[model samples]
Target: METAQRQQQATPGAFTAFARFVLCGGGVGLASSFAVAALASWIPWALANAVITVASTLLATELHARFTFGAGGRATWRQHAQSAGSAAIAYAVTCMAMFVLQQLVAAPGAVLEQVVYLSASALTGVARFAVLRLVVFARTRSQATAHAPRPVPATVARAPRPVPAPVARATAPATPAALCPAA
Candidate 1:
């Protein structure tokens, strides 16, 4: 069963996984970019980005586990933690890109900010996809064996052996000839 599942997972090539990753992670990221911009109006841009990053990472991880990487189930807590580590790196890249953009233009337009943020996200997202496929959600040998159903041993049915009948004996001592027929 585990082999079947592994084959099913392996059947999706890297390109297929990447396409699904883009569809799931990219969708969350695009929405997060707009969310960060909206939240920035009320809060500090860095804080807004951080908030959006955390929320988007959680959502994207679940989507990747279910659809992108064919993890076969919901994201595990360990997978979530590993994913968050990669997301933090992505968050840093985006923040740095925005900071650089701000340094270059005194008042950059929303469109320009989105372009920079999204470009940074795209670069990091590619790396994130690799990490997720290779490390975070990859099923280890031990894990696969642990979850696989154990094979039941086959049992053979046998007929009962016949028992010999017992003969009645006298209370007197037995002769040698009776004890030994060839005496």
Candidate 2:
């Protein structure tokens, strides 16, 4: 609790996390590129790219949530969902950026692809971490902290009243038809 308060007090600009993400993203990108290049002959570049992305993504997410962002194991399934959703949005932006930087701007072909990818990775990492840390995970904690269902006042709770056992009503016996004509 005290540590969190201190952190909030000492909060650096938001850009710091992004800068860290960019640097960390460099590391992740190197690993991912190797993973892709190694598997290139066997798999399509895009498919291998996706595989590497998912793996590096999980690694970066864990690092950012725990060490970078001072989050405490906050990247759970819901956190990943929000982060991944945000990353999807970021990917669109990344694609657009890559298109502009690579095709439109006539950036170098060979290494530029990786550089552009790293740029996009940095963007995606920063955006997704913020969403995961503050929006999704923080909201979960905030939900627990705020608006918690208050215990009902003991006075307001009515003691359970014993329900009476259902009585089985006696049914009247039906008289048989005077005589069975068929018999």
Candidate 2: what lDDT?
0.62
lDDT of 2 by residue, 41-142 (tens): 598655666676677767776666655554545467766666666756765665576557755665356577667766776667666757755685565345
Candidate 2 deviation (Cα RMSD):
13.6
Identify the runs in model 1 with alpha carbons over 4 angstroms from their true place.
2-11, 140-183
Q: Model 2 reaches what TM-score against the true structure?
A: 0.54
Instruction: Report the lDDT tens digits of candidate 1 across residue range 1-183.
Output: 867557464435689989999999999999999999999999999999999999999999999887887766788999999999999999999999999999999999999999999999999999999999889977732365465667788878778787877877776647867666783
List of clashing residue pairs for candidate 2 = none
Give the lDDT of residue 3 in candidate 2. Answer: 48
Which residue pairs of candidate 1 clash? Answer: none
Name the TM-score of candidate 1.
0.74
| lDDT, candidates in the order shown | 0.87, 0.62
